[model samples]
Target chain A: MNSILSIREVSKFYGSYQALNAVSLEIPRNSIYGLLGPNGAGKTTLIRIINQITFPDQGQVFLDGEPLAPHHIAQIGYLPEERGLYKSMKVGEQALYLAQLKGLSRAEAKQQLKYWFEKLDIGNWWHKKVQELSKGMAQKVQFIVTVLHRPKLLIFDEPFSGFDPINAAMIKDQILELKEGGASIIFSTHRMESVEELCEHIGLIHRSNLILEGKLSAIKKIHKQNRYEIRWTPLNGTPAPEELLGRLPVIGPHYDAEDNTWDFTLELQDSEKGELLRYLSEHGNLASFRERIPSVNDIFIQTVQKQESHA
Target chain B: MHKLGLIIRREYLAKVRNKSFVIMTFLSPILLVGMIVLIAYLTKVNDNEKRLVAVLNESPFFKTDFESKRGISFVPLHGIGLETAKDSVLDMGYYGLLYLPQRASLEGVTEDAFLYTKDAPNTLVLETLEGIFEDRLREYRLQQLGVSSEEYARVRMGYEINTATFSGQRSAKGINEFKAVVGGAFGYLIMMFIIIYGGFVMRSVIEEKTTRIIEVIISSVRPFQLMLGKIIGTSLAGVTQFLIWIFSASLLMIAVMLFLDIDPAILMQRPGPGGLEASLAQSALSGDDTSQLLVEEFLKIPMGLLVGCFLIYFVLGYLIYSSIYAAIGAAVDNETDTQQFIFPIIMPLMLAIYVGFFSVFSNPHGPIAVAFSIFPLTSPIVMLMRLPGGVGEGGVPLWQLLASIALLLVTFLAIVWLAAKIYRVGILMYGKKPTYRELYKWLKY
Candidate 1:
């Protein structure tokens, strides 16, 4: 797939402290890519470089196969982690100013801002100063300014932060809508749940190295273990399932006295599933069977731990 | 170019909307002019000075009319000797007794008189008496000399110089002083505003750097553009205020001038306070006094030149210093850090104004004066005061002033160059104390 944004072996240093070390990543077009890392893991440095806020010491960044330059600044929208909206400025005015700075004509910016205002239902806040808004409400205004230009690439650092669950869900829906309309977003957040629900593809950087990078489903599958839980009931009053018990590795099989139901974990040990199923059928009726798949959080912790332990 | 226009518009609108700027602009000139008028009004005519006389002559010739004005209360001492009159005058509340001794070759009792007092009279005291005595004496002379007032005026030959220079310049030798004083004050005020407010602009830049707003702005616009915009904007504010001050000051000045007893037309028409008429009255009776030797001639001569020089210095001087201040602002992040840089900027302004004060009345065209006035940094202030008095006359060539102005322009450009470089970097830097050495390093980058 063609990459919408590319950083080729990027490395940056701050007067002796290394921020990013030969980090390469590609964000595919029309995809929501999660840039995952712990604090001080060069996530912000890479974001800043992509935004052209600072130049990297030893790397190049490209947008849509072209080298990044000032004019291209108009093509990318950045909502920095530390939201900086002018405190005393009215919300609508500030948004228009920021939009114009991104190279939008005043009339066009106003038009786009009007639609955003209506969509976010913040039309009443147009005349209110930003300082008067709560942190979450201001975030909505900031989000509007960030996307007012309809940038081809939007970088949101901690986009869901300071948002209540309802607002968070609202912003998530808007992000997905933007992504659907052909915008590629680099979503940076330490919140793994956000990554799980929002990002289709992600690159996990632990200690300045990319430990895992792939589709969300594929990554989970790569780290999956084959383990299943089974719940059953006896057909009659007989507990004569000796062959089935011997063949299967049952972790725990306890009968509930009140319900007469047996629940147990089954681990396959070189035994064919067809043979095991026939043995179980002679003694009891199987009520339920399901495999436990690893969650994204579990995979993240495991990968980070593995890398840290090895290092 | 459009960006510059946008920037200028922001400055203009923001400053115009500020209430303090509007109020100060209109108030300062009014107060300044009102103060001048107030001083003139408060300077009341003295009303309590009595004179004692012990003229030894018993003849009516010794008792010639000594017409008195408001302050003078004259006491006659006919037939009294000088010693008795002096002693008697001390007991009374009189300042002194006039001691007129007889002269055998006199053309009538003549007119001049002398007085002794506890101390020398103040200018007001001396001026009042001198005016009254001269008026009465001139009448006596016109009669005794067998000449009408018109014939005596014609015969006196009133030495005049319809002054014309080699350059075909016909000059008004009169009111030359008043013009010089006005010009010097004008130049001084303009220079003062530029320096004081220019520093404000620099401080504003430093404040922005301290706050780190520069990073956000510089990301969008070039560093040079931002700094240029701020400086130009602040200067425009100052200019607006200055124009308002001038308009208001002129109005106040006119109002005050109306109430002042100082009409140039009136003062000019009347005989100069204590000059020819008083001197003639004194010399006619007391013989020519010889104590007027030490008056500085060149110091008082060219009021016109000083005034002309002041106008040139005011604008050029302000522009020159303002550029440096702007550069200094760009070099540092805060006022505390500016302490080191400030000395270099302030020393020239201080010296120039100090020199201006002295050069106003001293040898305005002395070699030292010429050097300071032409020196680009100090010229704006020094030449303003010096030019009025014709200091260093032939030495002050046109090319020199032009050269100074040209040099100021070049210096302005250089300041902007170095300032822009530092402004770009310094504004983005946070939480660091910038040293002089570090500043140099930033310039290199």
Candidate 2:
């Protein structure tokens, strides 16, 4: 896959504390990349560096395979976690100002802003001060400005924060729409569920280091335990034969008294699905057979907990 | 540079469009002119109050000496003692009573003469009474010297030495004081503008920092650009407001003059022949043409040079001080924390005004005035104070003005460089209020 942003062994230090220690990341073009970390895991540090709000003490950042320069700021959009608009400024005026700062012409900025305002149904709020808007409405204005320039790379740090669920879903849909239009997105959040729903690729940083990274499916596969669940009802009111159960690679066998069925979780141990299916069929009438894959939340918790114990 | 322009435009619009800014811009000039008019009117009314004095004279030497003038009237009390005269004056609501004792000789007539009033007598009344007796005593002394009253009167006419410098420049008396006043006014304006507009810039920086919009702005433009843009934009707004004030104030003055049916030339006239000794002496020197001389003296002032220097110094002073204010705004999280930082920035400006008044008035070329005028921090104010003294031939030397400008420019650049660093780091920092040490550390970064 082609990469739009590549951070090569970037390290940042704040005073005596190291914020990012030799952390490298490659964000693929036209894809949603999730940056997941606990609080103080250097997630904000790396994001700020990507936006050039601050610089790295070591290493380099590249955008579109070119070394990042000030002019490249026009191609990037950032919605910081702690976002705000000038409270006393008129909504439309403030929006136009920000858009112009992003290298848009007055005519283009006004035209694009008109389109977004109408699309968002906020057409009548042009002359109102930003302080008059509700938090959700203000967030909508902020979102419009962030995406107004049609930047190639969009960095959203906690974009959904301070939004009602309905608005959050709206922003999520907008983000997806932008991604569909060939914009690469960096979605940084601790919400694993949102990550699972949006991100195709993810990088997990722990204690200033990138500990796990890859395609979401591949990463899950690598962390998978090869566990399967099988439910069966004994035939002729008899339990499965002891010899058959012993021959199969089984770990825990549980019985459901209410359903009068036997549930067994087994380790496949490199065995084929066909072999497991055949063994289940011969033992008893197969009720249900499924592989148990870990959710992103589960993977995140396990990875972080394991790392903590090791430390 | 384009982004900087955008930032400046935004800042300018934000300030100029504020309701309070517009109100104050127009209101201040009216208020200032109104205050001047009120004070002048009250003084005229006070001077018009009539006072009645009753004189009880027992001496036959001077019965016709007492006379009534514009605001003071004297009445003679016959066959009444001093106490009776005082009581009658009080009962009749007279302003005061003047008693002349029948002394054997006129040698101690002034010392023995007395004036009594219900309250403190007006000093002008007393001075007038004393002048009558003094003239009588001088005539008596001149008669004793065998000089005739007419000859004595000719000799007693006030004499004023015409003064002219070696450079053949003749200065009217009190011209130096007038120039000092004009220079002080310019210096005062610079001080006031720096404080007012510098506060504007500081508050603006604080507002941006507090609202957290600075993060979004800095991401697009450098911190230096933002700071410079704010200073320049706010300054332009200030200049706009000042221009409007000048236009409105002129209109208001014209309206007032027409309403009161007063001549504009009379407004420009020097103080009338009243309480001022200088004007009285001037009238004694040239009875009717003192006002003409005053007009000529005013014309002699190099107003063009004074105004040009004022603009240059005003701009340079504002840039230097406002940059410091911006840095302070960035360093503190709130206005309250700014107190510790603000005093140091304003100390030199305050000191310049105070020192400029004393040294620049007494001797413009004094060591203190020259030092403060040359120093970039106080030059904007002190230099204007010294400007009226006129250097080289008759005005501020071109080299001194140029040197002051060059020093201000160099200092402004250096300060802006340091302030930009503090602003960059401090704008994003929250919660913790920084100390001087931390600011120094930011400079290193």
Candidate 3:
């Protein structure tokens, strides 16, 4: 895969405190990369370095395979976590001003702003002061300004914050659309569900270190326990014999008295799924069977907990 | 550089389009001129009010001396004691009762004379009463000396002293005081502009920092570029407002002069009230052709040079001070925290005005004035204070003026360099307030 942005052994420090310690990551082109971390885990530091808000104390950052320079700021869009607009300024004018600041010509800025405003159904709010808009409406304006420059890389820190569910979904759709249009995005959020829905690649940062980094599916697969859940019922109104149940490779079995159903989880160890299915056929009627894969949330929690306990 | 232009444009448009800016730009000059006109008219009206005074003269020496004038009308009381006269005066609603006691000598007559009123009479009324008594006494004394009152009056005129320099250059007696006052006014203007516009730049910085728009802005533009753009943009707005004030004030002054049917040259010839002219008026009246010389001396002032220097100093002074103000704004989270940092920046400006005025007024060529005028921190004000005196043996040297300007320019660049460092680091800092030591560390960063 071609990486649009490469952070190589970048480190940052604030006074005596280390914000990022030898952190490195490759953001693939046209992919949504989730940056996962607890508060103050250096996600913001890395993002700021990429946006050139602040520079790393050591190491280097490369954008499009070139050493980062100030001019490269035009190629990246940043929506900070503490997002705001000038409250007294008219929405359209302020947006136009910011877009022009990002190296867009006035005509191009106006055209892009118009298209975005129309798409977001905020065309009527062009002349209204930002103070007059609801928080969600102002967020829509901020989002529009961030993307109006058509940048090659977009960085959004907690983009879904302060957004209602409907607006969140709308923003989510827009982000996906931007990615589809060939823009690489760095998505930072605490919402694992959204990460699962949106991000293709992710880097898990803990204590200023990137502990896990890869494709989302691959990471989950590497951490998988190979556990399967089974639901069985008696065929002749007789329970399965205890001896037959003992012969099966199972970890925990649960019985439901109200429905007369047997549910159990099995860990595959030197046993094939087809053999287990054949054994269950002579004992009882198999209702359902499915492999259980750990969710992103579970993996995140487990990884963080494991690191904390080790520390 | 292009982004700097965009930033400046954004700042300029934002400020110029503000409603408060528009209103203040137009309204302040009107208010200032209106206040002056109101005070002048009110004083004139107060002087025109007529007051009645009842005079009870027990002395047989003077009866016709207490004649009535335009604003004060005197009524004689016959065959009435001082107490009855006072009662009748109060009952008749007179403004005051002037009682002249029977005395054998002029000195005793003054000691015995008393004026009683419901309230303390103004100095004008008191001086008028005293003048009448003195004139009568002088006439009586001249008759006793066997000389006519007219001859004595001619002889009583004071002697005049003509002033000139050792080089035989005919100079006005009070020219230094006049030039000092004029220069002081220019200095005061520079001080006022720095204070007002420096606060403006600081407030603009604080507004952007507080609103969190600075991050988005500095992402595209360097912090130094952003700071310079804001300073230049706001100064342009300040210049616009100042120009409007000057235009409107001049127009209003002209209109007022026309409405009052007063000569513009007369207004220019005499400095305003509380000026050196008021103190010198007595000496000027005693001297031969002093008013004409005073007017000539005022005209001899190098107004073109003074105005040019004022513009240069105003720009340089504002640039130096506003950069510091911008740094303070970046270093702090709010205006309250600015107090600790602001005092040091403004101390020199305030000191310049106070020390410049005193030193220039007393001795225009004194070392203190020269030192302050050459020091970059105080030069904008002190140099203007010395400009009207002219450069040579008696005033500021041309080399000193150029050096002051050069030093101010150099200082401005150095300050901008230092301030940019603080601004770059401080704009993103939140929560913790910074100290002077911390700011020093930011310089290294």
Candidate 4:
């Protein structure tokens, strides 16, 4: 698949302060790409550049193999972090206006809005003012507007914010539905759970540089700790688990005295599952066992912390 | 083109639906008409305070029961001492009192010598007494000359000057002065609005930038298009509001006609000296003759010219000032920060208004008014006001006004360029206020 959005060595500067430092990344077509970072880590700056809100000092951006131009703006939909809304405007009225700005005709906008409103069960809100809506409800309106014109690429910054879990789930499903229909997405958020649940690819930005990025599963596999957690009967605490403990380094070996269950974390010195399994079977009764794969949240925090301490 | 149409439609709908717009349009006419009626009612209520003064003829000359217009009545009194007179009048609760000297010594008495009340006597009573004294003095003088007052009146010589201003050209005279002042005043009002509302547009842009909404919109629309769309949209809204105002004013006039004695047709129909009929007559007779003192010449401004100049100035001046306003808006984050820039824009407009009032009076072709109006920065308003005066004494030369318009256009373009530079950078800025150096660096970017 073609890279729906590609940033090459993009460096953005505000006066002498560098907002993004030669950051380069690729978002493949039809993927839920998570742009993960701490605050002030240049994620917003990169997003802004891709949206064409501001120009970068040294970079070229390509959208689906075409050089990004003014005309191409219609092909990209954006939801800014601050929530671009005219407060005095009525809800459906502004939605139609913005939809037209995004290149939809009035009739088309109304038709699409009708479908979205019914789908979200907010059809009654059409005549109401946006200011009267609760923050979560307004977010629904904003989210609908973000995807209304159905641009080939959609960029959402903290899209799930100000939403209840039910609405969040609804919007999440919609986002996935968008991706399935071949729309590329750049989802920026501090909530790592969103990245874990929704994103198929992830990029870690720290201090204005792309520290890490890859397919979600591939990145996790690369950072895999080769550790496992096992809960088993310890043979009445007679140190009968030596045969299991022998094959691997016992990072954590503890026993719940009341439950009479033994728990231990082991790291494989080498990728030899046969040896580890054989040792476990010989020494302890295998109650449960599972590999401890690093989560995107853990990796994000670890990556940021590593860079901070290293710098 | 489609986007512009969309913007226009949105702006029109939003403005027409705005309660502020509706209320302002209807409320202004009500307030204006209500104020006129309120004034009339207040005046009528104050018309009933006639002073009832008591006069005793101890002087043996002046008459009692004298009348003084509708606001003063004198009552007869029996001879009384000064102290008794004062106490009786004060106790009686009269508006005021006046005492005259006896007929023998009245010659020695001065107009200021009369005294009775603690405060100044009622003006109506004083005028009546003054008239009596003057009549008596005149009769005494006529007796000394051994001539009757009727004979003296027959011998008086008086002549009135019938001067009419005409130099085979346009001329200003008499009530034309008032008309000129009024025309200037109305033109000044229109000018002030363009400046005020145009500045509002600029401030709105800066506000949205400060809030960061401009950033999201800018992604799909260029800054120039956004700025242009907003300006055009807002201007159309202004005109729309103005039209609504005119409509409401007519409706109010109709309401006043139907419900009250006030005639709406009085304004519409020509009546008496100051009527539009007289104005038309004055100009129609001055064919090929510019020195006509006719009210018609004073009203000679073609409606086309009036509207043309107004539209030209309204749009051109608004664009010019709005650009500077946008620049100021982009430079500052909040309204407080705008104080530094507001004065420059406001002062020139005010100065133009003042200059316009004096344009037709002292020097219709004076350097000050001409200069102000011919300068595109101020011309849109001042020029429109002076156009009724026939381009001024020298009548503003066509080239001069056109040049001003051209300069205004260039200035408008330049200001927008600079404002856009600031806006492109300013929208994403927050927390710390930008310094002059930082703002300057943004232009470099």
Docking class of 4: acceptable
* Interface RMSD, Å, model 3: 1.6
DockQ of each: 0.14, 0.63, 0.54, 0.45
**Best to worst by lDDT, what's the order?**
3, 2, 4, 1
Steric overlap count per candidate: 10, 1, 0, 10
Name the best candidate (by DockQ): 2
In terms of TM-score, which candidate is strongest? Answer: 2
- Please estimate how well model 1 matches the true structure, expressed as its whole-model Cα lDDT: 0.68
Worst 10 residues of 2 chain B by lDDT: B271-280
Instruction: Please report how far candidate 4 places residue B197 from its true position, in Å.
Output: 3.1
- Candidate 4's C-alpha runs over 4 A off are A228-237, A240-250, A256-262, A269-277, A284-291, B43-119, B122-183, B195-216, B254-294, B323-344, B355-361, B374-377, B427-445
Q: What is chain B's TM-score across the candidates, in the order shown?
A: 0.64, 0.89, 0.88, 0.76
Alpha-carbon runs more than 4 Å astray in model 2: A229-256, A261-268, A272-277, A285-287, A305-311, B78-84, B107-111, B145-148, B172-174, B261-304, B391-399
Superposed Cα deviation of residue A179, candidate 4 (Å):
1.5
lDDT per residue (tens digit) for residues A6-71 in model 4: 889999887778888888889988888999888998988888878877788998889887877877
Considering DockQ, where higher is better, how would the candidates rank from best to worst?
2, 3, 4, 1
Query: Model 3 over residues B230-267: C-alpha lDDT tens digits?
Result: 99988888888888999999999889877986444432
Q: What is the fnat of model 3 with respect to the true interface contacts?
A: 0.57
